[model samples]
Target: MMLEVAIKHAFGGFSLDAGFTAPSGVTALFGRSGSGKTTIINAVAGLLTPDEGRIASRGTVMLDTHHRINLKPHRRRIGYIFQEGRLFPHLSVRQNLGYGAWFAPTPAGRQDASRVVEMLAIGDLLDRRPGALSGGEKQRVAIGRALLSAPELVLADEPLAALDEERKAEILPYFERLRDEISVPILYVSHSASEVARLATTVVALEAGRVVAKGTAAEILGDPAILPAGAREAGAVLTAHVKTHHPDGLTELEAGGIALFLPTVHAAPGSRLRIRIAAHDVMLSRERPEGLSALNILPGTVHSVRPGDGPGALVALDTPAGRVLARITRRSAQTLALSSGATAHAIIKTVSVAASDVGAAAAT
Candidate 1:
């Protein structure tokens, strides 16, 4: 385990009692506001000493209320990235990053600055101050600064929430690189399902200050029952490789022996990627339909059907392209006779898969 946390704290009228183990790769704390996502991360970073709890990273104990062994924030060796870049406005990007490295306990513990710059592609902005950098560029520099600290773990508190959509897109690839290339474990906080689908390796879902579900990204996001935001945000992350780019501006991807066509993907052939397909965007049919404009279709069997309190239903299907989810009206589900062991076809329009929902797959 990379991190183990069990904490309980109460502030004002709200109470938080959550615990989970974070393995290697990015572990995301996912939930809505006031769900104690930030509180859990703060406990890990020593920003807020919980009323009573224990936190350990890489087997080193950072907090143990029972034993009264609490390490100071700096002694914990945690690099924290806030929603904003929080870079020094007066210092150049290079100096800002150096500030983090200077805090390393030992000279040998400092990360190579040049390599960090190259990984985040911030060498060009080293001479510029935070005031001169864009939102995306500033966030990149913030990430570089954190890496230079040589910390055992990195804590990102909704790092992309402060950015616009365009800036978020610009910064997401850097985070992907961080997850794939960096060996350090990450504890990230976010409420966006799309962000979780695109970046998280393991997901710890919180609701009302409690952990409701914990599993792989595919397991948490593909199942609608546990999602706090409900069916609209439920989706599946499919791993696919770019097979071809057609003349009609469609990119062809091969996923688990199934072909999926999507709007022009900005990746080279053979590049592996993760695609997030929303449950609401998928349509179910008993038989393979013909003469349709939709370019993607996969045959699968119904794994389960869950009827919501409302008029809708969520269906899970076991397909060649991994698990697929569909949200349809209960009336429609009965008319089509959707149930466990029933065969069906998942029809998806190429254009329904948004550009922001696609991301680079982590290297195995």
Candidate 2:
């Protein structure tokens, strides 16, 4: 499934003008609060029609100003998952999921409840009420509910914002399962950098109601300049597979020909994972340094250098593992005579790779 949006609307003092094309998989609508992220979602959902422009999904027009084709919210067939689960308070998990199927316009297209339950791991909660479940379990049930509706598109507005870090971690794997296993395209909204880095296949970045950037997660997240203001956590995401578990309490992962050692991972060998390497945690040198405490040293060539207004500069490097970014002082960059196409070695500490940043079972 694919979604195309191009619209402009005025709401009191805040005007929303945004556009982007989202292909199958998770397309993250990322921006700070009040960047019009929710506004665009509402437009696609047919709750708030745009003053002008068009919105379409899978070649079906949801809204068109010139043609006056505006589908009602229910007719749009777009499932919406709010920050809260929004499950009926009086209903059991099974009944709540059944409600999604009841409203589905096409009985043939309605997703099998058993399949969605297995995919989201909500089978155990099927007999319980939403109040009896944990935050993570509630979100999973909410996702299952949306999927059972046979939606062409699923819109999630900061679904993890209400959960604490632990609950967020617990629920994220289910989303990864949804992104990889499900056929429906998902429009996931989030302002969290780590969430975008770990979950998004494509990123649509908004700033003050405009699309500042839109591309694959690797392209958008790898460039610090495209990140939102105060987004100092800008980094590159590399695809790697678990290679082995050593007796030393560390797991070995391989990306391309590069090796990454991290604290013990629970996944079995050969499982694909996405590791996020923060630019601030990386240091680039003109040549490979010797006798360094850091265990990672990858040979690479300088791809680009972006000097910030402050004393820092962000540098991009093409490494064997993947594109790696480094944030260093302007003086350090100048001292090393760094420039585009220059040969350098990226220095990274294995310990700097956080266990929480490793995505499980994510497609490459």
Candidate 3:
């Protein structure tokens, strides 16, 4: 484990008692509003001292309430990126990046500024101030600044919450790049399922200040029962390679020998991508239907069925591409006799997959 956190704190009506271990890649603290996502990240960054418990990185303890040891925020050697860029207005982008480097204990330990600038593609904006940059550009610089600090861990608290859709699209790929190219582990907090699906390697799901589930991104997102956002946010991530592009503006992808067609993906042929298929967008069929307008279909066996308190039921299918989820009503389940070991076909419309749900696959 790269990061270990176990903390408990209370303020007013809400109480937080959460603990989890994060491995080398991006570990997302996922939940809805006021679910202790921010609180946990703050505790890890040494900004908020927990009433009890401890936090450590790479076996070095940053906080231990029992031992009366609580390092200050500056001494923790962690970089924090807020919802907004929070760059210094008086300084140019170059100076703002250098500010992070100043905190490094030794000059030799700092990241190469030119390499970081090129990786984030912020070299062009280095001469400008924060007031002149767009939301996405500012965030890129903020990430660059954090990288230059040479910290052991990075903490991002809903970094995209302040951006609109277009700006979010612009910033997400940079985070993907950060996750793949950077060696430092990240403790990212977010309530957005799409963002979590696109970026998280390990998921620590919180609900009302408790860790309800923790696992790989695929495991937590695919299992509807464990999803903090319920069935609406339930989905599975499929790793596919761009096989070809059609003249009709559809891109063909191959996943485990299964063919999937989607809207024209902005990627070159043979490029790997992660596609998030929402459970609500999928339909189950006992037999493969014909003359359907949907362009994507997969034949698989029913793995499990979880019926909610209402009329809806979530079904899991073992498909060639990967684990796929379908949200159907109890009536439909009974009508089709859906149960474990039953054969079914999963149908999906090509247009149902929004552009944001597809992202460049992180390096394994």
Candidate 4:
């Protein structure tokens, strides 16, 4: 296990009781504001001690109320990447990163500065100060500094919340690489479904300070019922591989022998990718629909149907690609008579599959 947390804590009118096990790779702590995402992170970081519980990582005990074992924050060997890059004003980028390496309690395992700089692609910014760097560049530097410390775990509390969409796009790939190539397990906390669907290998969703759902990203991202007000935009993550790109501005992707074409992706052929087909963007038909302008039509069987409070209903399909989700009106479902084990077709537009949702599998 990468991390094990079981705790009970409180603050005035509020109370927290949560526990989870983070496996290797990235484990996402998903919840809305005040759902105790940061509170759990603080407990693991030693910034906030739980009234009673045990926190351990990779066979090393961090906190145990029974044994009265509580390690100091520095002694815990954990790295933290905050929402904002907090760098020294006067120090150069290289100097700031070296500062983190200097305090390596275990210098034997300390990461080489040159390797860390190259991993984050910050070699050119070494001589510059923090004030002269862009928001994305500063965040990359912050990540490199944390890696230099050779921490056991990495805690990211909405690390991209401060960046605009453009900056977020610029740095997302580096994070993907960090999760794939690096050995450290990341406990990522986020409220956005897209981020969790993209980067997380496992998801432990929380509500009211308690875990409501936990599983692989495919299982959690496909079910909208557990998400807080995320049903309208809920979707499923499909593992795909690039087949080829054509001059007509379309790229073909394969998943379980099913071909999916979308807007041109710059990634080379044969690269693995993940695609999220939004439920609302998917349409269903009892029979294969023809004479339509839509480029993608997947044949599948209806697995289940869940009705929402309003006119919406979630239809799950077992397609060749994977378990895809479709959102339609209850009336349409009744008119089409969609039910468990019913044969159906899922239709999606080429333009609806956004580039952000389709990312390289190597980056995963």
In candidate 1, which residue pairs get closer than 3 Å at backbone N, Cα or C atoms, i.e. clash? Answer: none
Q: Model 1 Cα displacement at 195 (Å)?
A: 1.0
Residue-by-residue lDDT tens digits, candidate 2, 184-271: 7899999887888788988998989999998887788887678753447678888889999999998999998899888888889998
TM-score of each model, in listed order: 0.97, 0.95, 0.97, 0.96
Summarize candidate 1's per-residue lDDT along 1-364 as a digit string, tens digits: 4899999999989899999999778999998889999999989999899999999988899999999989999999988999999999999998999999988888898998888999999989999999999999999999988888999999999999999999999999999999898887899999988888889999999999999999988888877678755677888889999999999999999999999999999999999999999999999999999999998999999999999889999999889998999999999999999999999999999999999999998788
Whole-model lDDT per candidate: 0.92, 0.88, 0.92, 0.87
lDDT (C-alpha) at residue 239 in model 1? 92
Clash number for each model? 0, 0, 0, 1
Which scores higher on lDDT, 2 or 3? 3
Off by over 4 Å in 3: none
Where is the poorest 10-residue window by lDDT in model 1?
Answer: 223-232
Tell how far residue 198 is off in model 3, in angstroms.
0.8
Better of 1 and 2 by TM-score: 1
Q: Write the per-residue lDDT of candidate 4 for residues 207-260, one digit (tens) a residue.
A: 888888999878888775675436865888889889999999999988889888
